[model samples]
Target: MVNDVLAIHNGNYSWNIAFERGLQDLELDDYALLLTSLHEVHIKVGEDDRSKWKSGRDGIYSVCTYLRSILGSTESSFPWKMTLTVDNLHRKGFYVTEWCYMCKRDGETNDHLFLHCEGVRWLWNTILTSQHMDWVMPRRMEDVLRAWSRKFRDKDSGLVWNLFPGCIVWCVWRERNIRCFEDQAKTTEQIREWFYMTLYT
Candidate 1:
């Protein structure tokens, strides 16, 4: 819902913005609230859509649950936007300058930055292997996202691609930002290690 950041449900999320922001920056806890109770806010939304956020007995948790559902991650106790690879360079008043720093030919769109960048392609392979998950890196982020969903639709070989995607997306974006702002350099292994560290936390 709105890139995983829906507006407040009865002002609860608004009140917790600071705490949520802190957890996101630190890569800490992600909360999952059980939403329940509707119809009260209704008289408009039909019964089918109305009761989704209301589950438990009294449904006093409706507002928080509604907000969490909008976040699209019941497993995740924390709310996070999908990893954004696009640089803010567009805001600096230049269009042609969006080309990849490592691959001058391609624009630094989400697909290029996260998928086809020469350096990143190598890193992605390493990341998959280290995670002990069999994954094929697509030529573009869109392709990768599509394949990822299809691959993880069911469990196989004692692996769960579902659990790892969130961490993978998180780590890739972190590395991109590191190079962009910190002037740091890292190898494929280093990036994988970072992902592990973040995941365990």
Candidate 2:
């Protein structure tokens, strides 16, 4: 509820003379363009104020934005944060069974849950075959991405190819969570329908 929190007065932003003089003392007068972005934003009365983080595309904050601000973009690809597995939980000090919550056979991992689980294999194979693609499932998530990048060529086909893997991964993770946390289960067909609704809508 502070009016001058951002040094903005009467909804107008201007450099304080003392701060400008300090900047002059620091030999930073050449960086005066930093305050050029402080334009006025109109607030609509009777509307509840909503917080937004401006760094992300949708005006929502993400850890990626915070990391990039600090490290200045190393251009490193980060693993998907949305995918959760029992192994990850175990690593984080949770007492989860060290197996996939979906298949419950092999040890859970990002690679195993998304790529190598038998249930995931069935889901991927069925989806790919419906698209008239007979792809051999890759051993690792990175390999899956590499194979996907090499398989599709045309723009339309490329979009489907790009979104399909992510959709599948998301659906599988959702199903796993439902079974784990909610004690509810969904069949592959239900998952397929959810997948289409997710991407098409």
Candidate 3:
């Protein structure tokens, strides 16, 4: 039944007439947004329809997983902990410059300051190289944590490995605030030292 609306027409995916008429009743912006949302959805031919819980393992849903997904098991981690980056502050009507305090080359966002900034990458690379591992940084902080979780699964060593990312985040945020508010700064090496100290203690 749902496939009827998402039917293939003229060798391309097109909404049926009924769906098109329903879309006409929406406001212009909502209609456009809905179309944009649907544009990438691919329909599989001759397959049974099924539901999936993306947050769960193997597409199997459980209450515990659902709660963790919404609650964010890593809420204390860097991804959700800091929200007052320069860009966010600017968006909230503050007058701070949005440039990153660490690199000063790009706007300060959660991802840029924590993951992709040149100085931050040095910090990450230092840790990764010490572990004899190579990593491609993810676009989002949450994704970084997830990828790290998958890579470091050893029970004995995993605890420290898991703590590495959060420690880096904490150290970077402290350095950022110090520079932003205290007119103090640390070299990338100093930050790396601080990260190791935080991770071990």
Which candidate has the top score in lDDT?
A: 3
Q: Per model, how many backbone clashes are there? A: 7, 0, 0
Kindly report which residue pairs in candidate 3 clash with one another.
none
TM-score: the better of candidates 1 and 3:
3
Number of the top TM-score candidate? 2
What TM-score does candidate 1 get on C-alpha atoms?
0.45
Task: Please give the lDDT score for candidate 3.
Answer: 0.78
Model 1: how far residue 65 lies from native, Å: 11
lDDT of 2 at 145: 72
Clashes of 3: 0
Q: Residues 1-201, candidate 2, lDDT per residue (tens digit)? A: 423434555655444434434455455654454444333344443457887876777888898886665556553343543345666666667876777777878998998888888877887877778888787777678677766764556787778767878788778878888988898888878877888888676
Model 3 spans > 4 angstroms off = 1-82, 151-154
- Candidate 3, residues 1-201: lDDT per residue as tens digits? 666577765556776534434434547788677777777667666677889888988899987677677657654433353378977677668877669989988988888999999968888888889989888888988888777874445775888887888788888989988998999998866877778888887
Ranking by TM-score: 2, 3, 1
The sequence of per-residue lDDT tens digits that candidate 1 reaches over residues 104-159 is 46767666766777866666676577667676566655456556654444476225
Write the candidate numbers in order of decreasing lDDT.
3, 2, 1
Ten contiguous residues with the weakest lDDT in model 3 = 17-26
Give candidate 2 regions above 4 Å deviation: 1-63, 67-78, 150-154
Which portions of model 1 miss their true places by more than 4 Å?
A: 1-96, 101-105, 127-136, 149-160
TM-score of each: 0.45, 0.60, 0.58
